[model samples]
Target: MEFSSNIKKLVMLVNVTNSPTESEAAEDAHQAMLNISIPQTLKYSGVRTQSGTDIECSANETILCDLGNPFKSDQKASLIIIFETSGITLFTEQITSQLQLSTISEQTDLLPVPVTLNVKNTVLTMFSLEKQVMDTSFSGSVIGESAMNSTRDVGSPLEFVFRVQVLGEPLGDLGRLVIDFEWPFAVSNGKWLLYLTEIVIRGQSESHCVPPGKIVNYLNLTLSKEGTKRNKREVESVYPHAEASVTVLTTRKVPQFLDCWRQTALCQSFSCPLSNMSTQVEVRVRARLWNSTLLEDYAKALRVEVKGKATLRLLTDKPAIKMENHTREFTVNVDPVLGEEKPYEVPLWIIIVAAVAGILLLGIISLILWKCGFFRRASRREMYEAKSQKAEIKIQPSETERLTEEF
Candidate 1:
């Protein structure tokens, strides 16, 4: 009888019966044997079969071995086992068995996990307004009116804080992280300007791991203005009046980390100079992440991007002046004080009047002096009388002298 069956362990049994006619030690001993060969690729731990080599087996013997999977994910291979029997048979016969082994089970591949980003809070620390006032007549009194008004300057040493959080698998040591700040109305009319002075970034604890000869958790930031574009229509607009340039603020290489594995991140701080503007401003904040080992080229392949927005408003307070139509009259008696109250500016009419009065007083003084003979010249008749009197005196003196001589 011939039989074949599939089992974990193989066992072959052979029975040989000698006829009674073969007495005493006349019959030689009968022996049965088998040969087995297995494929080389099927060799696994705890199995004793050599690939492409024949293994001798005796009848009524069983062989046991374990079949372990050795193939990788999605791989295909074949296992062939061949067996041949010989040595003893009722009739001349040959037996051969072939089996095919294949490994279909595979491992799963690892995929990148998605990350989440969020914006926490936006605070406007400082605000100011620029206004131009025009004087207008109201009730015979001058009142000021706002000609143009806009937001002007923001207080200096200002700070803007941003928070980042990880949502997915832990990102390994990041090579680079970038945060870009863009002001939408930077190019609007009124020549708005925004200046950033300093920037700081903090990373999570797990992200502090640095590879050999490499620094992890570092950030690279840049500040620049958008390329200039001419907009004739915007320049002619009445509200803005002219086209302006956009401001871009970038931070220096600040160390930062996002531990997706641990779901944590650091807060970012930006110190800016006094920023001024005349219109509503929109700021766009963009954040990007890069692998620490790959650097720039691999950044795109394994990068994360998140965006946020903030709006700043300028508040102003101006005094209002008004004049009343009705008035009341009152009488007062005052005691003079030692100190004089002086006007800040003398009137032009008062200056002219004072100059004319001074000239008139000088002329009057000169006329009075002239009438008092202070500047008079001598008369011709008076001069002639004086000369006649002097001559008669001289003649009398001479006559007296002659009489004395005759006596």
Candidate 2:
């Protein structure tokens, strides 16, 4: 008997002790009935026959094989059974299975105990998802948007817009989106004063908007900058318009945790089973800078650098057909407070101090130059004349030198 991983085949051999002659074989034909039971994870396909004959059997019922006149006394006979996997097998490790056989006799002269045979699978059983042909890809990006004024300010409406797309065919049945935020969104004390006011989901075929009343109150807001709105608008312009889409959000409240610096995650089932169709998810989160203290560290401009990242996961019933971790980062400068309107003017004391310092520096530089004879430098014409006089004196003898020589 042989059973292997690549080919799910079971073979059983039986020996006949009593055999009749060929003339009497027509009156008594060897017949056997076998029971087949399999795990839920595996589905039973039809058995393979040697004569190429089709056998009809129900999917849910146990398979019974009728071997007609194949066995002979003192002759070897083989029975083959085949099985196939059902939906999916999540286990990748090796598994052991045993095939046991027993016999029963109704005659009083025969033994009451049934004969038994055990077959064990000794070879390594390898299970992998490589055989499942699938094509899927995931990508996403996050941005900040301002609703009230162009500038970010306290109590002003802000938005963290996230756009995720699952491209290619044969997508997953479920999806998960996790966003990690910086200090502006959450604090060290685990206190979330910033409220997530709204959540809007936009797809190629459908769109949904959830107001503040429906959302949970304990969510936080990430820091955003003036330039984020421009980026958000650009994403919207290129958003794909379609008649069919996947619904990834099924719950009203988004889950929040402190581990990811007040991370937020949304997990939902697809409206339909993932198939050879492209799906897009656009989530617009309305927020506010209710925690004014988050911006206290910045001076002059109410600027704060906010950072966030998103991870998208695609999951299906089959663990083998899975998408890896797809993560993206977005960082922007945000001004939580209103921008300073008045023109920046120099302070009176600062101007006086600057003027005094400048005068002192100039005086020191002038003194140094004067000591090095910079102030006593002669004109170009005077320098030329001095050079000529020196040349003449060198060429001729001085009067005093001539008198000394005569003496």
Candidate 3:
């Protein structure tokens, strides 16, 4: 319906020829209100007399009236009066008020509250309608929240509705063209006054963790518009608990992957005191996502020179001291950290093989000497040299004796 507010104020007068006879056709208009309920709260008694208009409807929409008489019609009614005002119209508005969680059944989710209204109507003379030609349109947030008793709660969705009557009380017929209706509702806790908007429950799922090592942080959740329409797309664009958050968990400080000991931790345990290790080393471990620029530079070998601190020890509540991923340049002169066991190591078989080979080599050498005639070559050479020397001495002596006889 094409609805207008100020234009309906018939201010100008028009000239007419004669008064027309009034027809007895009892033309009637029925108006209904859309609702917004707060969980854990009851509608206030002060809401019934509030005023409002069809701000969302079209021109054909007859002005909303508290079930009362056809109060008034201005010059614009010429068009509105003729049409068969039909089709359902939905009304919605937010009510603000204090909430009562005590009376509401304790629930993990939100609850809804109920409200009621009694529109009145009666045939009256033109004078009878002047007082309130139409109920005035009050802006949303008109209703207020009030205290509620949370003591009693039965199992239910807290699903209830409301209208223009005294909430939580009996409604009676009005003196005009309106019907009286009552709404029953339940309510829950919210940050605002009765949460004029539907409660948006956004949360992550439940999770568990084991003892020792690694961060257990991540969740899957769903958001629902409970009671009435509410969401993040347009409803709560600026709300917190949005994407700007990330969770962190730690059973024990993660040893750095770079250090000599921690590097072996994934496959086997190593002797590294976890107590003295940098608590911040986990940052370095997880910072792969951050891609530290200096590390990236070194990784790219972009420049031979870059100043950076590779590792920092983080003392934790644990008894051991150790850290990892320290730059090769950063050496911790810590006491030789020992685990309950020093890496159960195996002896290198090569050493054993070399010792066995040395024993076999010495035996081989002794055998060779025994078989090749130890001193045989030396004895033969001595015999041959002695015979040659004896022959030489006799020849020389005989030559000297012969020369002396001749003289």
Quick one: best lDDT, which candidate? 2
lDDT at 311, model 3? 20
lDDT of 2 at 346: 50
For model 1, residues 1-407, the per-residue Cα lDDT tens digits are: 23111112323222112222333322222221222233221221222233322333222222222122232222222223223322212121233323222223321221222212121111112221111111110011111113212111111112234333222212122111222322211112222112222333334321111222211112222322221222445222311311223322222232222221222222222222112211122122221111111121111222221111222221222111111111111111111111111113456687789999999999999999999989898899999999998878843457778999999
Ranking by lDDT: 2, 1, 3
Who wins the TM-score comparison?
2
Alpha carbon lDDT of residue 79, candidate 1? 23
> In candidate 1, which residue ranges exceed 4 Å CA deviation?
1-345, 395-406
lDDT of each: 0.26, 0.38, 0.21
Off by over 4 Å in 3: 1-344, 348-352, 367-392, 395-407
After superposition on all CA atoms, how large is the RMSD of candidate 1?
Answer: 31.1
TM-score computed on alpha carbons, candidate 1: 0.19
Per-residue lDDT of 29 in model 3: 24
Q: List TM-scores for all candidates, in order.
A: 0.19, 0.34, 0.16
The local distance difference test score of model 2 is 0.38
What is the alpha-carbon lDDT for the whole of candidate 3? 0.21
RMSD of each: 31.1, 15.9, 31.4
**lDDT of model 1 at position 52:** 28
